[model samples]
Target: MANEDRPRSKLLTRLHLGTDEPLEVVPFLDDTGHGVFATRAPSRPNRIGLSIVRLAGIDGARLSFEGNDMVDGTPVLDIKPYVPAFDVRHTERIGWFAERLGQLRGKLSDGRMR
Candidate 1:
């Protein structure tokens, strides 16, 4: 099947060095102290990141995708078909995010990870 015809997928990528600090605790965008696992802060113990994107097309070894948030030349570690049945979770608790969902709409990176 053509790439565009395929379903959306997930990319496991190595974060660029700009946000690759191994920080145990970092202030989230909201200025709350949170452990690395509790927030999407880029300074994790491991510099891996997961991005969900729509497959736009492929030419030879290059992949085109929508919903890209990484910089160009970002190293992709792996790709997996996005199966909502397995990836989606019906959770009542999202920890701190549960109370902060309303603030997510206009939030943007402030370069705090660097």
Candidate 2:
């Protein structure tokens, strides 16, 4: 929240970006190295929330989307288009997650950020 709080800026359009979790700092306090950066945890040191929901439609000021993983009233902070050429990477090695890849399919957020 800013002192000159206003509506979502027009600069952000048809983009996917970060928001503010606003509820807690560091969703998983006991998490090891790199903290929230190591995981897709909602709450982080900067309170920046991120989602890659599809931009379904835009009616004036209203934006309709699908596949949202966040809750209601999440404050958007920034936005940018999902450019596959710049974003996608074919990598087999991911730090810390290399060994935990098998568990991802069954894993779920347990409200640690709330």
Candidate 3:
């Protein structure tokens, strides 16, 4: 397979989980039910994280992107092209996030997880 270096703006990256105790469940924002898998809580059992970032540019061996949610120096496990057809899902049931959608904008992470 030819390694197509075509400029793809979207990329899916697997990252090493940060330093946090593995939690089975946490109160969502201290108000909702946030079972570990139900919420994007950092402390997961597997200690692996997934993020979607915008591919900004390729400079020799360096790559930069926007929308990096991981901490600085976070180890990246893998990377793959983000194909919307396979990644995007149109589903009405988003579990707990469905009701909290309005709180997303301007909402910053509190140190509760720490």
Candidate 4:
């Protein structure tokens, strides 16, 4: 099928239903598909993987996500895949974020990232 004719894939926006209370998305800093922060603390945090979401194979991708912005196990409302063919840019900078990646990796591995 042609690109325009092909059906657009929709990401499954699942709420972390295994809880007493409901949580929603909290916008933070990042061009990456609107980072979702934790609205409230949960007994057991979990990740709601969006169909478009992917673990950044880049050196520091995970660290950025694991930073203080997102708490353990938050339900993401949406995700849009970064189509490198279109999203890639000739110029890009790691910014101040590169520094925090190490700390993020430590905390994030404990019990985060879906």
The candidate maximizing lDDT is: 1
Candidate maximizing TM-score: 1
The lDDT per prediction is 0.76, 0.51, 0.63, 0.38
**Prediction 1 TM-score vs. true:** 0.78
Q: Write the residue-wise lDDT of candidate 3 on 12-73 in tens digits.
A: 33445444554555644547446677777666666677777766667997777666666666
Model 2: how far residue 9 lies from native, Å: 16
TM-score of 4: 0.25
What TM-score does candidate 2 get on C-alpha atoms?
Answer: 0.56
Q: What are the per-residue Cα lDDT tens digits for candidate 1 across 1-114?
A: 765666889999988764545555555446667768887765677878899898888899999888776767889999998999999889878887877778767765566533
Better of 1 and 2 by TM-score: 1
Off by over 4 Å in 2: 1-34, 106-108
Off by over 4 Å in 4: 1-82, 90-92, 109-114
lDDT by residue (70-114, candidate 4, tens digit) is 434454565455465775567465544454456554343333334
Q: Give per-residue lDDT, candidate 2, residue 94.
A: 75
Candidates ranked by lDDT: 1, 3, 2, 4
lDDT of candidate 4 at residue 98, scale 0 to 100: 54
**lDDT by residue for model 2 (1-114), tens:** 342332222122222234444433343323344444666565445545556566656799777655555665555555656655776789877766666667657455555434
TM-scores, all candidates, are 0.78, 0.56, 0.71, 0.25
Of 1 and 3, the candidate ahead on lDDT is 1
Model 4 lDDT, residue 54, Cα: 32
